[model samples]
Target: MSERLPPNTKIRGTGFNISDFWSWGFSDVLTNSLRGVFAEFLVGSTLDVLQQPRIEWDAYDLMYKDKKIEVKSAAYIQSWHEGQYSKISFGIEAKRAYNYATRSYTPEPVRNADLYVFCLLYEKDANLIDVLNTEQWHFYIVKTNVLNTLFPQQKRISLSTLEKITQPVSFTEIKETIDQAIYQ
Candidate 1:
């Protein structure tokens, strides 16, 4: 009554391969977790930013010299439909306060790190969603204070709006741009 895909067989008629279909079925938690890991790997390898050791809580994801960097990633083609273009947003959360006396967290608007690096995978054609293709990925860097002031009371920002503040940089330019922002 049911049919199963043959081993080592590629599905035809559909634009996506088996892996794409498989990824499409992933839940939001798993999808976001994987995206974060991928972003960390790209930043760590390309910019030579060292990943912080695993901890229960971390304010930042990577360390570059004395500066702390937080990396965020989003792809247009997720586990759902593949549109013509992908729109990505970065979460600019208001800082949380840890009260030593109460042993609880409180809401506060504070800069969590020196810089925020946003990795966006904007596919020219959503049908070709390949993680291995670096050409499809774009990296943008912005100072936390600048973001805090520009997007006050906002929890997220779009790529287009971010470009108005600072132009997107290539992977090779990420380190240099970040250094300039840090020391400036």
Candidate 2:
């Protein structure tokens, strides 16, 4: 894994810095890719796993204690002009696991994580939307076994189906909920 450089690290023979690139590239937190990574960061922070830099293109998004976590995020209001709130669904497809040591993909498709954390930026009003606010987010933590049993071959899961599988938890309850899911 490549070490995460400090934001203040300066570019070679230039006035630019890593923070400059971050601001230029990732200022739009509402976009799918950035939002997904943000959700993972939130989960990692809640679980006290932000001590290390995130592993990109890994089989799972996080590892807290013994549980491997996958994070998926979607927002009601999009960065684009969708006129209305966007439809909410999360990808739950099985994927070929990547082995970092071997630097290769697994032969068979699999759900490599122990759990999934579905994060919803639930603020519908674009004018009042705040991606940084914890209250605006709702998280649903579900075991991989449950998903495999219910949606073995499904690629995406609608919000209604996700709700039926598990109720949403707030930011404060995430760690406790995950503990219960892991230990119970």
Candidate 3:
């Protein structure tokens, strides 16, 4: 004879709740999705630009006027604990040709977008992951052409190195900063 347990019932003496473990695993995916969305929203709202909500995996996150903008975000406090400030790096991949038949990507040295926006959540205290706190978040904008020429073979750029080439700007100053980078 066998006994069936209820959906919410915990097994004999394991001492741990299975549902709690599942929630822990799912939190990573949720956190990442939220982070990306928050970054896009912050940029769009500050610049007074509308976001393209339906676009996915299309290279860029938002479209403003005649420019294509790619947004990348990083946080100091992630799933694990860190002893020091987290190093932030945003991917700058060249647009590649995809072969549908073979499902392979060919590397091309072409820039996909006009500009890149790097967002950082630098909270030394791991407890502060709240997107509502504007002071914890920082934004840096750089031109795609400048990044390609400076980084060349590198696909990622660190915040420190990026600061050498360009300074971090507030959300409200994004448009003016980008315009300066372009016209200068």
Candidate 4:
């Protein structure tokens, strides 16, 4: 375990299962990754075009311009079931990275935004486990309209609808979705 550490890694695995511990850390990694990915897309594809400042709230995994364009990451999951497969919970599993530039802490600023869109990567070919890998990074964007068709159910809900989950996107249908969003 010591050998695996760089030099100042705060984590110590004197007796803990390093592999198992690492698995939990994956959630943190994914959250941050999604934050960065969402921020980049919001700023690059949308804000940059509109000429906005790129500011990221590292602690909250938030980003935007004039502190109005808010961006977030989430996953989607079934909410009307039970058990792990039945009951649905949101955090880091079944959701999408979202951008909320249309709203603000104030009422007027929230309503006056010009172009407001909440984007998701909506991968077609990538897998869930693959995204969890610290090495593999899929920081891309796809339109909400396209994201809907990929999933079997709803399409294009308000950004607030996305789950606040933080787990890696499941590989199941991920690659398939990415392919669809990117190509046809």
The clash number for model 4 is 30
Off by over 4 Å in 2: none
Better of 3 and 4 by TM-score: 3
User: Residue-wise lDDT of candidate 4 within 69-127, one digit each (tens)?
Assistant: 22333333122212232221112212332345643333321122211223333323323
Clashing pairs in 2: none
> By TM-score, who's the top model here?
2
Candidate 3 lDDT over residue span 1-184, tens digit each: 1343333566458765656654555445216566776787788777677533424555566777678788888877665555665567777777774544676765665656788888887766766566567777888888888888898778788877988988777766777887776677
The TM-score-based order of candidates, best leading, equals: 2, 1, 3, 4
* Least well predicted 10-residue stretch by lDDT in candidate 2: 76-85
Q: Estimated TM-score per prediction?
A: 0.71, 0.95, 0.70, 0.26
Worst 10 residues of 4 by lDDT: 108-117
Instruction: Report the Cα lDDT for candidate 2.
Output: 0.92
lDDT of each: 0.73, 0.92, 0.71, 0.34
Better of 1 and 3 by lDDT: 1
Candidate 1 lDDT over 1-184, as tens digits, reads: 1344543456788666666765665434225567677777777777665434333255677778878788889877775554544567888786774655677876665657789999887765545766666677788999988987887688888877888998878777887888889888
Q: Model 1, residue 160: displacement in angstroms?
A: 1.8
